[model samples]
Target: MPVRDILQLGHPLLRAVAEPVADPSAPAIANLVTDLTDTVAHWRDTTGYGRAIAAPQIGELQRVILLRLPGRPVWPLINPSIIAHSPEKLVVWDACLSFLSIFMQVERYEWIRVRYQDQQGQWHEAHAGREDDLAELLQHEIDHLDGILSLDRMVDVKSLCSREEFERQFKANSPYGR
Candidate 1:
């Protein structure tokens, strides 16, 4: 259960598209998912925050993402892709493990249809949306798999704020908390 170091924003690795997991059944991929799960849980325990984390965030150039949405068990997505999306958009103040202390408002589709494979090589599809916090988290992590960061999705550049400032000024109405 190694909690790997989460790569930061300026890291070159964070800016490059991650490769697909060639074999979902590979031991290395399992290890990578384990590390991601450990890291996300640790971050939540220490900061009382964190929902999902992508493999790329830990410098693994593979399309794997670990999610822990409210009231659900671990959802490991390998080579996930958004097959379709709603025209509706939801704006939220987003945060990331890559830049833990920073927050910014970003626009994401209100709902999306996705297809992904599990760690065991099983394929599945699901629709996610803002109603359950799945849409935003999925979009955020999938963007990581494609080398896109929240900074690049900002709806308003002026929406950038430090965690302290965000809490003091915008936390109440911030779409991130839900």
Candidate 2:
């Protein structure tokens, strides 16, 4: 599978809620999971910063996301939902594969409880906290499924900056982690 073109901020598809997958085991969905995983991997290899990506980012109107976390397997979450979130919030300089040239400072939940399914159609749930990168990543990608962007959740619109300016002014706020 090839890396699909990631839609930009203004694209109408990005604003539309993705439809839930009816059959997680279907070949089409399986292929989408593969494409998404490959795309994020390709992004990390090229830009050196990527953790998760949603199907909508690639112009696919499906409720699916692929996550690649450190010390874990690369997996796809079908119809993922945030069942719970902590009251605490963290200021994060969030970026997306869809908009690689920009970054935004947005407040995200310090932790979240999520329910999702694997490609095999197995359901799983977990609590992802700030102890790892999943907290920020989950919020970002889940937002994509609901047609929300980091720009929408930004605590400070002035926090928006291009990659160059972000690197120069807020290098310490790098969202990337090992």
lDDT of 2 at 68: 86
User: TM-score of each candidate?
Assistant: 0.95, 0.94
**Local distance difference test scores for all models:** 0.88, 0.87
Best by lDDT: 1
Tens digits of lDDT, candidate 1, 101-159: 99999999999999999878999999998666788889999999889999999998789
Q: What value of lDDT does candidate 2 attain over all alpha carbons?
A: 0.87
What lDDT does candidate 1 reach at residue 85? 96
User: Lowest summed-lDDT stretch of 10 residues in model 1?
Assistant: 169-178
Kindly list the per-residue Cα lDDT of model 2 for residues 36-149, writing each as its tens digit.
Answer: 988888888888877889999998999999988767899789999999999899898888777878888899999999999988888999888876668888889999999998
Clashes of each: 0, 0
- What ranges in model 1 sit over 4 Å off? 175-178
Best by TM-score: 1
